[model samples]
Target: MAASPSRRDRTLSAHHRKKQPEQVRRALLDCAAQIAAEQGASAITIQAVAERAGVTKGGLLHHFDSKQALLAAVFEDLLDKMDQEIDRTLADDPASRGRFTRAYVRACFSDRLLGDRSLWGALSVAIVSEPALRALWSAWLDGRMARHAETDGDQRLVAVRLAADGVWLADMMEKDGGLKRYPQDFEVVLLAMAEGGN
Candidate 1:
């Protein structure tokens, strides 16, 4: 009383059998992220990703249902990595107060978020252009903010975080790396503010 597998399902099963599903999925995601970082998100078609990943279109499809889903996965992967980086930063700090805010400042200034050549900078365009991607980013940020409210809920810390955001936005908008013009102590100042220092 069960229905037979469709041709597409059978093909996907074959592809899964040939390649480790987790490995193939990771490869596809990496390839897609690389393409987006190198050529912009507009170049991330199923064909391009499959070719870049050295997998067939069916194989890529077996991992991602569509180009949008693949893109979402790529963004999610980046977010997860960023989350880990923040945790690593926080782990270095002994103080609990403003720890999350300091990590946010550090991340905003990180090379990964500052230059157009960085993956985050490259994906910034896609995030602005894609509504779904934007929503995902917003949701992730909101969750992080909520999770850190206990330690970083002070209004002064919030302002410092917003200033860090401004710094990042200015860097993202500038082509010649204008953020470097600020005094070398800019981040130090921000970190002090993050801890409610004068």
Candidate 2:
């Protein structure tokens, strides 16, 4: 019989084995996102994503059955990532409890700064034009905002939330030389609103 594998070999075997499928899935998603970033959402289809991912169409179908499913996956993945980021940001705050409002606002700004909004923004045209995608986001936001009702349902808090989203949206949709003016202390202003200092 062959000699038993060494610990190093076994460890490498397990690590690579575990990572393979997840890496493939991540690669597929990245390809789909790149398509959305470079070509717009309408360009994302099974064949297109497969080609971008350097996988067979059958491989793409193994991950997503249809374009609708693919788009849903993209939205769900992106939202899930943002939710995790919000949770982490909240945990790092000095006053964690009852600070969901501050955490939520900070998270959106962080997303604008260090996140994937540009790719998602490129897909905004598709999101706006596609009634189904619009409904998907609408329902998701409705449920999410309901959960953060204390922050989003109240008038004062809602104003800040909407204002942040509006700014981010404007930034996303802006074309060169369209507008350059923004409140210099915007995040500071948002923090004040969130902290009831305004």
Candidate 3:
């Protein structure tokens, strides 16, 4: 039997109604990121994000209890995004290679990691300004580095890892400001270094 027109409309409407809150929450997060990028942390108030997101202040509060909560959510979301990219890049490694280190290097150089400077800038600010957040970030990176470290070649692992960081930093500086890029051949040199010449 065919559904009545009003019943069909009601089913679609109900589905959209269920999605409304999630849509609003996403909008609020996007507004928060934009504010952090464009105006820095001081500008990312609940009222500001709500207005930017076309929602009431109460609507924002429903998703985030406070400004700190909101910023933490934004920071964590960016980190999750970064981790996913690193894992995805890591998955393609071959068996007979410096798998972990190469994956780490490739992950650093990925567009996923290079994405959205405003989000990166905001998270960087948070990490630098908050001691707890700084400690947490340090622990996470230290764990990754430890896992990638070669048991018999700690110095080589550190060297290649640092080279990857150097490459990532240079790339960010060039895009974030007007910092001059390294010579065009530098990335090739950096990746070769990551290969550990094995």
Which candidate number maximizes lDDT? 1
Tens digits of lDDT, candidate 3, 102-151: 66666555542334444565455566677756676777787766665553
lDDT, candidate 1, equals: 0.82
Clashing pairs in 2: none
lDDT of each: 0.82, 0.69, 0.66
Per-residue CA lDDT of model 2 for 62-97, tens digit only, reads 778889888877867777777787778767876632
- After superposition, the stretches of candidate 1 with alpha carbons farther than 4 Å from their true spots are 1-17, 112-114, 180-185, 196-198
lDDT-superior candidate, 2 or 3: 2
- Model 1 TM-score, all chains together: 0.83
Better of 1 and 2 by TM-score: 1
Q: Which stretches of candidate 3 lie over 4 Å from their true place?
A: 1-21, 95-97, 111-118, 146-153, 166-185, 196-198
lDDT of 3: 0.66
Q: What would the TM-score be for candidate 3 when compared with the true structure?
A: 0.67
Best-performing candidate as measured by TM-score: 1
Q: What are the root-mean-square deviations of the candidates from the true structure over C-alphas?
A: 7.1, 7.5, 6.9
